[model samples]
Target: MTKQDALFQYCLRLGDDALILGHRLAELCSRGPFLEEDLAQTNIALDLTGRAQLYFQYAADLEGRGQTADGLVYRRPERQIYNHLLCEQPNTDFAYVIARQLLFSAFDRFLLEDLCTSKDERLVEIAAKALKETRYHLAHASDWVYRLGLGTGESHRRMQQALNDLWPYTGELFEIDDVGLHLLEAGIAADLHTIRALWTPEIRQMLQKAGFEQPADDYMHTGGLKGIHSEHLGHMLSEMQYLVRAYPEATW
Candidate 1:
């Protein structure tokens, strides 16, 4: 693929991660365990959506095919999306939500920091903006991981179980292919290999502080980078796309 195509794909990957996870968190609005948690989640969802717009806008300009960010976000089928599998997974429960956030946010925080130094001016600005939000996301989720992990037996077990189930998907966040290498070579992307060194240790420390043991499962679930995802993404697409599908260009 050409350099432009590769960079566009890279932006889509970043946009998809923010969009999918933002929507996932938005689902907790008014459905959280408490009012404060609900507001917190909703706020973070807004932050993520904003970050997604930046990436999607850049991707559209890079593609230069007259595709707007809205078109890319609302018009694509689930199979065309390149979000990580972890972001597409269902919230399931509160413990599951925090577990997913903790793992992904921890990785995101570090990755964005590395990206802040990227040679690409637009990407560096976006990464710098995103890193600010991701740091808080990591902190909040980590607190809950500790709270639930050290609480009563039932809460502790649930948190541990969520970690075990979600751990498999975490590996996908670090899988760099030729597209990644292309960006890296151009100084438009950070080396995830180096990021992984930091991510792994921080995650280990977080889990230990929460009193949760890391699962021994060697099989790491992947494939979302190639547009292959779990069923949850399809359902999410249906809801997210309904308005766009019904109204081609509705503007209020």
Candidate 2:
């Protein structure tokens, strides 16, 4: 693929990841386990959705397809979305949701930090702006991971179970593909290998502090990054794309 195509596809994947995860978190809008956490989650949800909008806008520019952000986000089919499986997974419970947030945000923080130093001006700018928001997201998730892990017996148990269940999917976050490889070669993206090294120790420490044991090494489920997703993604896209699909050219 051409450089532009690779870049555009990379942007779309980034945007889709943010959009799907934001929607998942938004599902907990008024259902947070606590009032403070409810507000926190909503704020984070908005931050992510806003970031997705920026990503889609950049994608439109790169693709030069005359497609708006709404077209890309709300109109795309299931297989067209390149989000990781972890983002679209159902938010089973508070612990599970927090585990998802913790894993994604931790990696995102490192990724954006590295991206901010990219040789590509546009990517550097986007990363610089996004890094600030992701830092906050990381803090929020980290705090919850600690609180739940170090809290009461039941909370600790639930948090441990949540981490274990989500562990299998975590590997996909650092799975760099062709687009990523090109970007890395051009100095326009972070090194996933390096990010993984930093992320793993930090996460392990957090789990330990929460009095949680790490799960055993096991094979991880992959493929979402390549447009192959779990069963949950189809249902998510069905709901997310309904308005656009129902009225193709309709706009407010």
Best by lDDT: 1
lDDT of 2: 0.88
Task: For candidate 1, write residues 1-252 as lDDT tens digits.
Answer: 888888999999999999999999998889999999999999899999999999999999998879899989999888889999999888889999999999999999988998998888989999999999999998899889989988889999998888899999988999999899998998888799998999898889878887989777599988888999988899999999998898887953
Output the lDDT of residue 10, model 1. Answer: 94
lDDT of 2 by residue, 104-211 (tens): 999999989898888878878888888898899888888888888878999988988988988999998989888899989988878999999999999999888878
Alpha carbon lDDT of each predicted model: 0.91, 0.88
Q: Where is model 1 more than 4 Å wrong at Cα?
A: none
Off by over 4 Å in 2: none
lDDT, residue 205, candidate 1: 84
